[model samples]
Target: MRPPAQNPPTPQTPDPATAAGAPEPRTSPDTPDAHEPPDGEEAQVIVVGAGPAGASTAVHLARAGVDVLLLEKSRFPRDKVCGDGLTPRGVHQLLRMGVDIDGPGWMRSRGMRWVCAGRQVTIDWPDLGRYPDFGLTRSRHDFDDILARHAEASGARLRLGVKATGPVTDRAGRITGVTATGPDGRPVTYRAPLVVAAEGASARTAIAMGLERDPRRALATAARRYYRSPELSKDEYLELWADLRCARTGRDLPGYGWIFPLGDGRVNVGLGALPHRDHGTIDLRATLDQWLARLPRHWGLNEQNADSPLRSAALPMGFNRHPQYSRGLLLVGDSAGMISPWSGEGIAQAMEAAEVAAEAVVLALTRPDGPRRDQALQRYPAEIRRRWGRYYRLGNTAGDLVFSRFGYRPILNGQVMSRPGLLASLARLLTHLMEDPPRDTADHVLNTLVKAVPLRGR
Candidate 1:
């Protein structure tokens, strides 16, 4: 079956109804393939998807004077199911992209509040000297649309309502561009020197390029819904619950629950679960129904208060895909399975990968086509693996133990969470927010554990 497009490897259409002053859908019933790839202008790189990762890549590349084109099947102000919480790492990426976070509709978070085993402790985000001291939260419907405009403002050409069907390749099998349909449903082929698949969880053209998800890696699922919560909507702390037990087995499922306040009279509430051998896949929607009933009545979150229906999506965790860069095509975000097995965080990693890929693309564009360019392209995956391989490998194993029904353990039990001092250190460790060179014992200990796991990819 074909995968759905988060943003097709083309531009997302601007809804005249939704996006004020937005351009009309670049289509002509009289014209074939709408305008064709590149339409009227030429492009050096073509990006699939207008999500965080893809849009970020375009922003960076456009700033470097590279001609980048974004293809998306949907229109602006589209809704994407997400936790809508940004960690310090994600905040850093947004700042790097020059997003105006001080504006309205943005909520600042001081820290994460962990509720486990009837004990709750708030752990402030670490000042690791690499990321910001605070994080921000905005719904993806606004967030994605904002980022798409940011990319366009950076000089990237966007073609709206175009769905990238597959990769266009050379005889030797390197992707040169993408095959897509216009808003009017006519097929068009876009050609460029390099291609990027930032199409969220669905691999899309990357799959056409011979990349398959690695079954050995951890794959997770998440269900989330928005709720109108007058009391907790403005909360500064993102709340998490770790004491969730399965309704059927009463066993600790290997996943955590989250309540991320959006500060707009609503909060994004959800739970994510890892598969277990004994129970296999758990029913997340049903689990969510059970979970909502358990929330404090003071928070004002319940079925009647739900702002949106419960929606579930897959989280391809732990670098589940191989050769993130290959044969002139690069994968970013969910397409590359950049979600952390440790925290189920993907946006920060995806934006970081977009930056890394942009840097590599800029350098490769400096060289003419052929082996030299391909060599530069190789750095994309290599550097990605270098940065994340060890952490993911370790997290994958840890996740297995945490979620496995036979060996399920509450890593954040009362014993560990009750002690604020210890939980503070553990929080830093779990979030991987430590400076290199071993700033302290916590960093050293955490680094040692991460390094002990043999990395999977080269």
Candidate 2:
């Protein structure tokens, strides 16, 4: 998932930690007109938070000749607690953003290795013309920096060390911009015609705009720590352990654990759980410690080799937040709760939503501020929900059933893992990697089934 707002360590060595903020900016009572901003003082779009969603949005908007302001609470080369695994879907987004994946520091992955119920299987990424048939892993410290710099180079005005406090609204309660606390610890106000909330799962700006998260939706918590594991560092497959159990109750967790090799003597070890309403309390940190202890000693995952502290954050699943576009404010990335429920992946969704939101904004800006512009802006959420709604609904149902009592074991037993065809199908389904018109019979059937599902609350 996208890392929550946190300050990282020195650029040379990235470390993840929580964040701090200051008071809101005060508006002048006798300023010029309320409608007009000072000369050269406003942007066409204000993007809060510089993670994948914000960076992607700013990059696309700048490429389209839109003046964008990208604000971040942290500087470049900062660490964001993440699994660091980029699937083919995410890779496609990076490639579209012109990121050099073949360059140094990018660890390529061949496929995925599943370990559960005393069964193991390796499934390679599908070979499809629509997507690159490979995955990659790079720490968020480097990953986010690359994206932010890329966006800046594309002409987006990126402001680091600036924390957005809240949205600045007009008399009608429509958001005009955001007031922030700059590096000087003083309040500053930035105005824009449109504001994008890419501020991760905390969703500060969206909440301020009165777009609350839907409590009926599923929410997951994830904890991750880095380790120096030479043995696994060069592995081509992204390893997933599905046999995780709760530390307190011995119940199966509703999520999976991952070991993503970074090809640099380091591996990101983490687990995420999408707990249902009745799902009891499970300590993610203790569960992570328990799982790591069971790994082979030769892997060197002990505390002595730990590269980072145990950092944990919430993964808001599905479209947990509503009305993605509200009163000139748009939600993207974790702010809209766009993380995948089945896979616990946020980068791909964030970037994809950024692209969609950028296009919508561009279209909206083409028209005057009226019903037509509002209609164009409203299409953003509808389009996003149309693309991912049914799939996530299916995932939520499966997670509820599969992560329950003896839920995961039966599915992962040798009986199901033995068949390569079935395993590959399962992989494609879980990762949401498929092309239209179908690559094969499996993809055809899968796409048909997903499309046939009755959609609700579009």
Candidate 3:
């Protein structure tokens, strides 16, 4: 689906009477096709999905003077179900991309306000040499469009209203490109020397290449809706509530809830939970309804104030996929299951991985089709593991062991919440904000601690 226009109408408080209805369908005006593939139909690289990961990869490659083709099923400014919250880590990626954060529609935030068992604590983002000490919240409708446009401006040929069906392989079974359906609903083939799959959780391209999610990893589901709440609209901190309890047992669930202000007379309300193998089944929609019903009446979380229909999506976390690079395909973002198991944040990790992937692809393209190219391509996974392998290993273990037992309450109720220094350290760890080369005490300790742990093995 396409969005209303290039200039998105800012998300505003919805009228209570009209709030519960379905959203209007928006279509792309330029549906004929923006850029048609050449007679050869070959590019230096092909990136699937126009989300943060793919767009970022295309942007980096295009800026480096590579002929990149970016394909997206949906058009620009389309709706994407998300919390719309950005941490300092994500903010760093935006800045690195040279996005104009100083412009309008940017909802600046100070930090995170966590609530558990009626006790509340607000932790400001730490001031570090590597990252900014602030965060922001923006609707995904406009966020992804901005990134895609940024990539297009950098010289990536973006094909909208196109869906890639499967891989195009040669005799040896190495991916040469992808077979897709064009906007006219006709078959189209686009060739490339290499393919980058950033196709979110489904990982269709990667799956067609014989890659699948590891069954042992933890998965989370989150449901979110918007509400008109003037009081919370301009709150400087992203609010998180960790006290959601199951309906029957009244026991705390193994997840967290959030209330992110949109700064436009509306707020995003949602809850995310990790499913336990032994827990059988959890109805995410029911759970989200139960938790929102418990919110303070003045906050206006009821159906009367609902600005959008409730939406939910699965979260693949803690590197749920293996062998990030196989054959001639490179996996980035949700396709590789790079979402953090700790904070449930994926944008930052996706963009970061895109940078690494772009660098690897650039190096590989410089070399001929030989051992040198393969070595360069192999460095992508190694650098990723060096950066996040150990940390995600610890997080996955915690999800399987700690969160299942007491949720996040034990840590929230402990002295760590009372101690600002420890809380800051925990925040940094959860968001993966620790800098390399040891910038400060927290970074030094966190880096050393992560390195001290053994990397997870296949």
lDDT (0 to 1) per candidate:
0.79, 0.82, 0.81
Candidate 2 Cα RMSD (Å): 8.5
| Ordering by lDDT | 2, 3, 1
Off by over 4 Å in 3: 1-40, 456-458
Please identify which of the two predictions, 1 or 2, would achieve the higher lDDT against the true structure: 2
Candidate 1 per-residue C-alpha lDDT over 301-364 given as tens digits, one digit per residue, 9 for 90 to 100: 8778888988989998888876777667889999988898888888888899999999999998
lDDT of 2 by residue, 263-318 (tens): 99999999888776687777898888888889889989899999999898998777
lDDT string for model 3 (1-458, tens) is 11112211112222211233322212112123344332225688899999999999999999888889999989888998899999988999899888889988889999988887666789888888888999989999989999999999999999988888777655334566777888777778777768999999889988877677889987888889999999999999999887778666667778888999999899999888886877756676777788887778998888899999999898989898767876578999999999998889998899999999999999988876555776798889999998888998888888888675557887777577777788778778877888888888998899988887898584
Arrange candidates by TM-score, descending.
2, 3, 1
Listed in order, each prediction's TM-score against the native is: 0.89, 0.90, 0.89
Q: Provide the global lDDT of candidate 3 against the true structure.
A: 0.81
Off by over 4 Å in 2: 1-40, 404-407
Model 1: lDDT to the true structure = 0.79
Better by lDDT, candidate 3 or 1:
3
Locate the minimum summed-lDDT window of 10 residues in model 3.
1-10
